[model samples]
Target: MEHKDNRYTISGTDIEEVKRKNGQSGMSYNEAIEWMAKTTGGRGTAIYSDTNMEEVKKQNQSVQDYNKNKA
Candidate 1:
């Protein structure tokens, strides 16, 4: 999902709620984005690909692995 700047206007409370409900610190960026898209309804053409998502997932996994090893 390619998010346009100023395209979605979700409230802080709503964002917090989503985070709280979706796993808080464990929530991935893509998960939060998915929630926002669902909450706000979809519009405009998708100008992005899943490649960005794959990168995010990779980074997230890296962090998770680092934390696990640290612990």
Candidate 2:
């Protein structure tokens, strides 16, 4: 997990590992929150608020822009 500003980014490998650990059933919402707290030193992402939403939007837009240019 990488923490910069208010964003928390977890890799697909990490998510797969979590799923594997949880018997492939996947984690519940609370389980994911606990994992984030433990893994990120208590700096869990605020799902209740708009934390990092802008960054996520910007990233998505960037990808769309890149694909448009490539095409």
Candidate 3:
């Protein structure tokens, strides 16, 4: 039942699905978004045209670079 910018696309069911899939995996929301982006072969915010695609790219890249450094 998360609402963002007056958009009500995601429902409680969706959250449950996400939680179920993330069980014992410790996947944060950002990690899920990144994984979805990689799996779908598209930028994560492709559905939100108002979002800056470049920003998403930078975020995804930053996460990857951080993981690389951490490892």
Winner by TM-score: 3
Cα RMSD (angstroms) for every candidate in the order listed: 19.0, 20.4, 16.4
In candidate 1, stretches whose alpha carbon ends up further than 4 angstroms from where it belongs are 1-51
The residue-by-residue lDDT of candidate 1 on 1-71, one tens digit each, is 54454434443235555656777466587765666565664453133223366788999999999999999
User: Which residues of candidate 3, in runs, are more than 4 Å off?
Assistant: 1-48
lDDT of 3: 0.66
Model 2: CA > 4 A from native: 1-51
Better of 1 and 3 by lDDT: 3
Ranking by lDDT: 3, 2, 1
Scanning candidate 2 in windows of ten residues, the lowest lDDT window is: 4-13
Write the residue-wise lDDT of candidate 3 on 1-71 in tens digits: 45673323454246655556779678778776766665665554455234577999999999999999999
Error of 2 at 23 (Å): 27
The residue pairs found clashing in candidate 3 are none
Q: How far out, in Å, is residue 48 in model 1?
A: 5.7
Ranking by TM-score: 3, 2, 1
Question: What do the candidate models score in CA lDDT, each in turn?
Answer: 0.60, 0.66, 0.66
